[model samples]
Target: MEYTKLTLGIALLVAFAWILFRNSKRSGVLHALIRIDTIVGMIAGLYLVITAVHSLFF
Candidate 1:
C-alpha cells in the first residue's frame, strides 16, 4: 500500500513536471491538462506531508 502510494505520487509528480515544461501555447486541452496537473500535484504534496506527520507522531 505504501509503495503503491509512493509510486502514484512519483508518477503524478513526473506528469505535472512534464505538463509544466512541455509548452507555453495555451490551447483548451492544454489549459485543462494544466489544471488537472496542478490538482494532482497538490494532492500528492498533501499526501506526503500528512504521511510524514503521521509517521513522526505515531
Candidate 2:
C-alpha cells in the first residue's frame, strides 16, 4: 500500500510537471484545462506524500 501510494505520488508529480511544460504552447480553454489538471495533480501528489509519510511513521 505504501509503495502504491509512493508510486502514485511520483506519477502525479511527473504528470503535473508535464502539464506545466506542455501548457507553455497552448492557449484559451485548453490552457485553462491544463491549469486545472496541474493543480489537481499537485494536490493529489501532496496528499499521497503526506499519507505515505504518516503511514510509515505512525
lDDT computed for candidate 1: 0.62
TM-score of each candidate structure, all chains considered together: 0.48, 0.68
lDDT per residue for candidate 1 within 1-58, as digits (tens), equals 5556656666666666666555334555566556765767857855865675565567
Report the Cα lDDT for residue 38, model 2: 76
Encode model 2's per-residue lDDT on 1-58: one tens digit a residue.
9979988987888888777666765665456565776788889998997898789889
- Residue 35, candidate 2: Cα error in Å is 1.9
Residue-pair clashes per prediction, in order, are: 0, 0
Best by TM-score: 2
lDDT of 2 at 46: 82
Off by over 4 Å in 2: 25-34
Cα-based RMSD of candidate 1: 4.6
